[model samples]
Target: MTAGEPDLVGPEILDGHLYDYPAYYDLVFGSDCAAETAFFEDCFRQLARRPVERIFEPACGTGRLLYRLSRRGYSVSGNDLNPHAVAYCNARFERAGWDPPAVLGDMADFRLRRKVDAAFNTINSFRHLDNENAARSHLGCVAAALARGGLYLLGLHLTPTRGPRDMGESWTARRGHLGIVSNLQSISIDRRRRVEKFAMSFDVYTPTRHRRIEGILEYRTYTLEQIRRSVESVPSLEWIETFDFAYDISRPVVVGNLTEDVVLVLRKR
Candidate 1:
């Protein structure tokens, strides 16, 4: 353990990093690993004009994607606000010695002396910036850190329509196992703020036990139109493209390229 790393993986709760290792990424991604990797790799191949020699992954939780990309010959540099996540990624990369320092800092104001060929925030992490100013600051920072004509890719979920909040729920019971209720939900937008209040709650069962561990996640959403206004305001940034699902298509529907999330590829204009 490093100076500030937490001791446990699941239920051991790190101060800033996510608890429940191996499971965190799995749950968030839910069996979409290979597809997601291929998506990111394809983006890199196109935007950087080659497989990027050195790349940056901000909010690189657990370093799963970083490790995968590094193995493919890309030098991976990463940073996250969570100390526990940084420590865990460091340990995993130490064996291969490919791990650069994954720093702990504010994503909005991070600085690196060495520039990267490409920079990315994968898996909808950009939406977590919380507000327009933070998002703009982050965009500016990314533009500044890239070498000339470097690529920037961001994959994030589109803001849900703030009209009707649809909530659905389901439960499952296994043999001799505890019953659990999974939450499926949505929230309407706050039209004034161009944000939505998303709410979700889940109840989990212990192994073969019936006690439910419940939690909730709330989010503020940004619609495509809203995001467009913000992206267009930055002088050094250009929104080259957006992919909701597939990166390969001729005259793909740009506006509708959004479902669960949107993937936007940008360049320093």
Candidate 2:
């Protein structure tokens, strides 16, 4: 049940495109503004006021948040199920003069030897659970990690109302240093997978040439209602804030929707 190099996965990178988790993340999000992203993560930590002695990111691909938190004076540790990701994190930790937290099996249900003061799922990471039961199990996992009053912060998403949405795609580049891609992503749920599939057919082209270096990234989504229902089942779960991403409009967006996906700050009761 260990997650190490032999068990990790990276992009086969066949047919001119495709990478495993780290390659996929580097390609998709591009190496841009990592500090900015980390700032928000620290914001969550500050908001929760939890002394994050040991932190866990279930989907810590390439150690994005883990790396940032470590740089910022936190004793950070994490587990990424993808072997490629886990390997990358281990290397990063070694280079940083730290011992990488051993990655256990799947995020759906994992048990760490050490208890943590806080844990989080940021940037819609919680949507990976795919089904209701798995999400609930993970929520319980979070509760078990806490010390009676530990905090769990999640930047989750609500169900997107179906429509064209003027969804467009675009890509940008930065001379020879790096390339940037901003594209329209359409995410829809498949009842069979119980997971929302985000379809991206965009490419990051070389600077000035505008030739497409093929990048295909697909991430399945899970709904906020599913998260709420799951977390509620945990005996000591308590939800404090319900932040909205409504863009300051009159009412909420999307029909048949009753929940606002927010940075759910949960305290183990």
Candidate 3:
């Protein structure tokens, strides 16, 4: 009913990797698919040096956004490390009578058959690189896959310049007979190592069963300076603009010490 409000319905608790449950994961994150697609299209129109058509996504869990973009006639392709998610995405495309585009691959090192007009990886997925070399390598791969002047919209949370702190968020979403109450919290922060650990739990409600799925994950932390350096490490990509999670193209924000959620628009040189 409200943010972080506990559900009244009791659920059977279980520990599991969230990515393994593609259907439930989609329900939690796919609710805003349309809006996010619109924002990406606007970004391409407003910032890309060439007309945007072909698109790519690294770590495209469940292929929700890719499917949405494909329906809008944009050539969309994506890769993910999860076999379940890749299978789920392909099945979804087949059920829709469209050609499947999702493939199994890693985010830090992968290539495309052809260069795309734009690429994106959002919602702090980039932070999973876990180190400077991996982060820079991923950027290099994206740059190599993009046509000259193509845009790569990378979204993630930046560590506060003052210091790291424990924080959390929660939300609820429902689709037909299924509902999801999701909670995500930062369990640990190592400023020296530039890493943060998170615990994510989802209370899933269905007609036949109710279960709580929990997962622990680690993400590499980046300050404003650190991210700037990472971008600079990739010679082909230039950091063009910065926006918050609001996905507003008109309102570019200067990333600073206090900035948390950041969406960086990188252009391939």
Candidate 4:
């Protein structure tokens, strides 16, 4: 799908990331699919009661993880609210001669006819729930879809209880003659509500045109206690363990010590 024309300001431009530019989603962020998928596979083997065969991904944009996991011989299915991204993912799978299972569905209220052995919401995608109610609903939906002893691998950076912290990160990716540089920034932090607002700007360079696409990306930040509460509310899921981005299952989560990113491994009861 073609991207919308650039608009630097206003709520209209605050659409979710990749809403307007689904074509660049995989090119810009899916380069590490192999390593990330390996890490997830490790968690599944370590935490799941039975061998994992069926996998599901919520908010599986660009289907990078879905594609990689499928290639590795798992029954992979995914859902994203963005119809365009979902369309692109389905097309990609069909082009590869596989049946497409990706669909347009909201995380807060999605269900499948078949249960999965494991499910995931990686790279801060869980944060997109944006509020307590929505977060609970999404968790409930995921829990309802898991088989007994199934696993849920969730990855995100917890919001610190300490004073404010501002960070920025940028990366560049090129495809043939087209190059795109993306800058991600945390624009607001609401400690009272445990929410953070983000802004992502992408500069696209092509032979005929150069443009910027940017928007607000909000997250419902979770402290350790907050995450515990959220998970506990869904009795079907038991908090199994927490690991830093390094994906070490043996490492313990120290309350006062944490890296910028964490992976929470939960098991179905």
RMSD of 4: 4.5
lDDT of 4 by residue, 27-108 (tens): 7887667767888888787778988999999998878889888999999999998888888899989999999979989989
TM-scores of all predicted structures: 0.75, 0.70, 0.94, 0.88
lDDT score of residue 61 within candidate 3 = 93
lDDT of 2 by residue, 155-183 (tens): 66565445323233455434353343445
lDDT of each: 0.63, 0.58, 0.89, 0.81
Clashing pairs in 2: 8-83, 9-84, 10-20, 11-19, 11-20, 196-221
Better of 1 and 2 by lDDT: 1
Cα displacement (angstroms), candidate 3, residue 156, comes to 0.2
Candidate 1 Cα misplacement greater than 4 A, ranges: 1-23, 49-51, 160-184, 201-213, 246-252, 256-260
- Residue 25 in model 3: lDDT: 84
Better of 2 and 4 by TM-score: 4
lDDT of 3: 0.89
- Candidate 1, residues 1-269, lDDT tens digits: the string is 22122324433223322233333433434334466567767766666644467788877777777777778777788888776777777887897876455777766788778888788775667777878899888888888877767778777666545443334334332223322344445545565765544444333344532222333344546677877877887778788877765544232345542344567788775
Best by lDDT: 3
Candidate 1 accuracy as TM-score: 0.75
> For each candidate, C-alpha RMSD in Å?
7.3, 8.5, 2.4, 4.5
Model 2: weakest 10-residue lDDT segment is: 1-10
Top-TM-score structure, candidate number: 3
